[model samples]
Target chain A: MLRINTRSVQILGQQISHRRLSELSLLIFMMPALVLVIAFVIVPAAWAILISFTNQSLIGPNARNFSFIGLENYVRLFNDPGFWNSLGTSFIFVFGSAFLGQFVIGFSLALLLKYAGVLSRGIVGGSVLLAWVIPEIVAVYIWASVLNFQSGSANQILLAFGLEKQRWLIDMPLLSIIIVNIWRGTAFTMLLFSAALEAIPDTLYDAASVDGASRWERFRYITLPLIRYTILLDFILITMGTFSVFGMVFAMTGGGPLGRSEIIGVYIYRNAFEYREIGYGSAASVVMLIINLTLALVYLRFTRVEWSAEA
Target chain B: MHRSGNSLLLRLSEYGFYLPILVFFFGPISWLVLASINSDPGSAWQIPEQVTLNNYLQLVTESDLLLWMGNSTTLAVGTMTVTVILATLAAYPLSRVPFPGKGVFMYALLLARVMPITAVIIPIFSLSVQLNLVNTFTGAILILSAMQLPISLWIMKSFVDSIPIELEESAWLDGCNRLTGLIRIVFPLMSPGVAVTGLFAFLAAWGDFLIPLIILRSPTTFPIAMGLYRAFGDQGSVDFGFLTALSVLYSVPSILLYLFARQYLVKGMTAGSVKM
Candidate 1:
């Protein structure tokens, strides 16, 4: 499949058949990355998956010491009411933060920027990214103060307006995390949609306008369809990102008030580190992996990257 | 694309559109600054009747704040450098070379990036322990680099792909290997992307909290995040003033970084999203 170079015709164009040598050099270049990935990411991951089927403890030295308990861990997981609750909480967090929250705000912001003139777009986009660039833990701290029940800035603002203080974190844990996540993450969605929106040819919109389409009609027919691929991409990426969230929740609430915000990450962290149930924790991770892969596969099936090839 | 002449209604709607944005986004950051400056923690959390520099002074005087800052900067810079280099080399073949099993390799890297880091934390932690890398700056960097490689690689591959293949073809015909072509030609064009992705990787490594908390058990190796969280949360008595001050300081470096690299970061993030 290599294209013949016309200019090289005059010269003695050599066929470089040193494929093995090239492959070896490539492997040499790739060795460090491959080794680290395999040792840290792959080996441990595979070990954890295998451990999920066994009764391994944190104190155990060898992988062999643990008895292969078959699918008991999985069966126990099914019987555990707390696991289901955690799963439900994880779903709520993902949907609340990623899908319904960031998606709507980010998509709208992109639309607003698209309609606005260049100066406005630059200012809004730049300002939004300011928040996005801040460290997530720092963001969590800032929001934690804002969500403080008594003396926090949120209640202070509410009190300034002569309204009752809302306990953002305590009264509503899931909603609080959702809002904070949206605040931290919407910039990403906005950036994606903005790029997609800008790529839409202006003539298409002009054509729609000439056809007497209302602003909403043009947006519905032209804007949404054009950026649908980007939107799907955003949805999938955000889903994965938010599903794995731990830092923000840890910094803000630490899965508090009776583990109300205990998503799987916190749950597994507690299981492994706190309770020393390393085997159970590995089992939980395996479950999480299954969930994430299933979701990713479903997204790929639905979006079908080929559909966006023309775009 | 039609531009309606400026009308009173249109101008009114502009204000309408901007109002909510200002309220939601600007309000919290403004409050954070205000709270950080106020002398009294309780009243600072409330409407600050007065402001002072004590919160900042208290933060600087109370702890190893400078050391934490240095740690974060070092870690971010290190992680960025490693991530960019490895990702670039990995991305080149995936984007350009029509090698067999390329699709599978690309998918593997993608899955690694998009998969939950929390899911891998225990495994990574256990591995780090085995390697005797736990609590070291290098260990944290390694984890961050691995965690960040997937997205950085994906972004980099797309950027490389968009470069015209003919340019590389000519270099290849001229007896230059792939590395030479990449170094002298492709790298210059791809530098913008490299800068952006590096910044992102740095930010991710810098911003991370859980990895440091889980792996770095020693207090001396604590990043600013771990330092502040432990200082604020673990202490029997809470010091809101110190927490606010630390948070403000943490926010400043990252904001300064963004301001310096905003152009590259913006372009990088948007262009990188094309495939995601």
Candidate 2:
């Protein structure tokens, strides 16, 4: 019995060492990715957080002798009307373009495609995707031209019906961006929902219809519940994406006539680079990060419930 | 006859519903095309009396358009190569090998994805200045690849997970090691996933505007996005024809790539969400 125990112990020790060897090798394999991510993303993010507590500037007297001023920038941010306005604009943009416009329209289109023939699906899907695949700068330029004050295609169409031409960018800056964002972004939501919709078995719908269910009833009971997770996922992704949008809005309006179109991203850029207030900008960035993290946490909690229920 | 007539009416209504969407989607692109070729810039909205390609010619010859295209190509290709190689290497072990703190590592990748570039730009900008890496292709490539790593890793990990372990184990029994087994067996199986991930990385790097706008100040170093923005700033509202022409030229590469690789793109895009 003693000899057998010793042999078993030796085998177990070898097995454990082999496993450790493999783990070490795996770590080595992961080294490059880990190094790059740490160097570029993790380090810089930490540095930015630190800088947020200081009175740093890109230029002027503070450029040479900036000192720590803990929480002052955050306090200034809370009192600053510009920061508040930008936050408000961000929420409006996210709600308008992401929630109401993209989600509703894209899901509706996906539902519409379910009933349509293949030819119709191909054409409609292709068209919407064209807007999505074009580079952001190019898309912005195209939309800018279409919304040009005079001789623009939009005004031309409006005037053809004898409606007065309004200065789109100036008169309704936020709305114009919201519309353009909807156009550019709907395709992603459409595709996501389309994939989700296709996953539901047709037998469920067939059985419902056989039982004398109405179209609306079938959708309400069967489709929405089936796609609830997908809708949550899309909400989280699109909200984050739209919140980070800068190039599109910048090119379209440069945050516009008064800062009416200045979302958080543009606001940060304007402060950091344009106004040379690095510390103030970092403070805004920290706030933006916190808000995003909070939103994600709330949505993640909802998703967790869904996950547990499904499991 | 009554059922057929009902079906026909349904189909007609569906087509009608699609009309507005189609027009909205295509109208701007069609207008840009028209403006690009129109001889008379003043009558941009009207039918052209004569078609011309002078605007495109001038864009290539007079401006820094070609140089920007070169820069964009280098950035995109470099990003794709680095992202694919590093992501695949990292993903293979994460999927196949179990380790302590693995869950934490995976969560970190997700957190990285959630963190916006805007939040970190200040420090990254200052750091790049300190390192004297501003305006360098290597700097853009490194940052872009890092930014792209999380998604690429996620996608590749899923792909690697889908592959059966027995295949590699059999290769091991045949006197091959893990690296060789991976190269010989797993890579071919995951080629589609790799292609999709690479395509996405390319798209991200190519379409990036803000990074290059911040980092590359010299005209010769500008990517297409910065170049087009500079062009727009220079011309403003004075020359719609030139602007439209540049926009068309700028859009062609990405549009063509999308059309070519859409199947992979869509599959890769939804892989993470659907799996979750």
Candidate 3:
């Protein structure tokens, strides 16, 4: 078989072995990466499931010799109000940041950039993208200062307007994080929508205009349909992304003022790392894995269709 | 990519719309730049009467900021090297060789790429402990590189796919074996791909907080990210000057890289689907 055996063969005036080499070389090249993925990503994902059923801990005897306790961790997680609160907070975070904030703004920015001058496009796009490119901690620091109660930029602006300076992080923890996430994240959707929009030939829009379609009609008929898949893909990616945001919230609010902003990542961190309840944390992680995997499956299948359509 | 019928009024309206947006988008980060040089930095924004380098100097001279940055650099460079080498090796065959289960393999990679790292951190922590990789740069680098490899491999494969197969074949007829041809013919062309892939791997490793947080326990081993978090955490007396300066310093490399790679960023994030 050509798959493995590299016997003398010509296919369409090209030698397969010359380009692809033997299967031995294939194994040699792929083995290192495969081994790494297995060790880090694949094994740990499976092991988290195994650890979820046990009483593992970061400290004490259970750290090493932890035994299975059979569904107790899951049962406790279900009943625990903290876990429930964390899930609700996660949904709010994802919905607020991904749907309300990033998607809406990013889409608008993309649409605006489609017709804007080059300078406007560069500056606007660059500013939005700058927020994204910085490290997560830097983003947290920027927002923390901006929302700092006494001398923060937001408070200063409020005072300048002769208004009260509300305790932004303390009183509105969830909203604060949502705003920060939006600031940091909108660039992705903007870039995505921009690419999708650019691919839509202007001729279609002009033709629609000539056919007496209004602006909204042109957008609804041509633009929306063209970018529907991108919207779906963006949703899946940003949801998964925002849902796993640990560092930003962790560094900014510590998910704090009483778990008010404790998204799932912070929740898992609280349990596993902070509380040292490895088993309980692993249980939460299993749930997180399942949700993300389901989304990833949809992503893969959706992208497959998209790619095939392109071909 | 251009469209007709941009009336002057419409173009003016577009610029008008961008005013508030530019303010909103650009407003927050001004704190970082301002506070770092403000002689009397505070939580609130203030334009200083006198700009001072005291904060930057103190950080460089007094604190372990340099050490933390060095560790971060070490991790980033190590991760970049490991990831780029492995990704390029795998990508070469993946693009050319037709094999059984290749489709499944690629899908598995996509799955890995998208799976939440939060879901598996607990186990990864334990794995590091067992392997005696805890508090070690080797562990951090390997984990970060592995985490990056799924997408890096995908990106490199797409890059390879973009290269003409005929070139390799033509080189094959020139008395050069695969290695020489790859280095002589393919590699020169592949350097840009390598650069893009390596840059991303470096960025991911540099910006990562969770792995370093859980795996590296000691302050001595902390990256600038963890260091910034700790410096800000002594909540009672948080040093605004130090924290702001550190944030600015930590951000410079990533921002520079972004400016350099902004053109490629869209295609890269989209997983090499778009042609540049």
DockQ of each: 0.43, 0.47, 0.52
Regions more than 4 Å wrong, model 1:
A1-7, A10-13, A18-24, A60-64, A117-127, A160-162, A301-311, B1-14, B41-51, B169-182, B187-189, B259-276
TM-score of each: 0.89, 0.92, 0.92
Candidate 3 matches the true fold with a TM-score of: 0.92
Clashes of each: 0, 0, 3
- True interface contacts reproduced, per candidate: 0.39, 0.52, 0.60
Candidate 2: residue pairs that collide: none
Question: Alpha-carbon error at B128 in model 1, in Å?
Answer: 1.4
lDDT of 2 by residue, B1-276 (tens): 997998789778877878988888878777778888887754226666789999898887787778888999999999999999998888888777776667556656766777889888888898888888899988899999999998788789878888988687667656566678888998899887778788888988999898898888888899989988877776535576777788888788888888767766656654445442
DockQ leaderboard ranking: 3, 2, 1
The TM-score obtained by model 1 is: 0.89
Docking class of 1: acceptable
Candidate 1 chain A weakest ten by summed lDDT: A302-311
Q: On a 0 to 100 scale, what is the lDDT of residue A21 in model 2?
A: 78
Deviation (Å) of B189 in candidate 1? 4.1
Docking class of 3: medium
User: What stretches of model 2 exceed 4 Å from their correct place?
Assistant: A1-20, A299-311, B1-9, B42-46, B235-237, B274-276
Worst 10 residues of 1 chain B by lDDT: B267-276
User: What is residue B217's positional error in candidate 1, in angstroms?
Assistant: 1.3
